[model samples]
Target: MLIVHVAVTVLLGIGAFFLLVGSIGLLRFPDFYTRLHATGKCDTLGGGLIILGAMIYHLFQYPETLLVSAKLAFLIFFVFIANPTATHAIMKAAYKTGVKPWRLGEERR
Candidate 1:
């Protein structure tokens, strides 16, 4: 349906936008922790949105591919669960390694 197409397009576009913003933040942020936060949160949301859009489009376009749809659903669920957990793990490791948090007006040690 035309409405479904439009909605899918919009969702994909927004997802792409969030991914772009997250990438920019990763590069531009001054500190490791800030960059991690930006990329972790934004990438999770962005990836989820993209996966959601694809799942919707596939559901409408290929009603017979129930298995494929289920796989996509699994991917969505996995990314949602895994991305943040990985990010948190990385942050924890960084903390354990003595990577200091950035403070305002203080030089990075």
Candidate 2:
């Protein structure tokens, strides 16, 4: 039980770290496309991992409650669908707005 708790804590911590890194990248990265890439990939991964850790913790802590498990599964499913769709929408909007990608070796003017 203690081990499970520790593992869950560690996983959640890692997920939080990734989320923070993604946010910083979104602010610090040059160009819109690069920022979008960082936010989309890292944020989704962080959110997924965080949800997974929570689900694991809940399963271990409440084995008899199928309702909690089902709820967590549903949350994960929604996030998996929503995050990618949001990212796609952002990318599509950027493309339509003529937001250009940052070319390698090209200095920001």
Best by TM-score: 1
Off by over 4 Å in 1: none
Worst 10 residues of 1 by lDDT: 100-109
TM-score of 2: 0.87
Clash-forming residue pairs, model 1: none
**Candidate 1 to truth, TM:** 0.94
User: What TM-score fits each model?
Assistant: 0.94, 0.87
80: Cα error in model 1, Å: 0.9
> Residue by residue across 2-71, what tens digits does model 1's lDDT show?
9999999999999999999999999888799999988998999899999899999999999998888899
* Per-model lDDT: 0.92, 0.87
lDDT of 1: 0.92
Measured with C-alpha atoms, the lDDT of residue 106 in candidate 2 is 76
lDDT of 1 at 67: 85
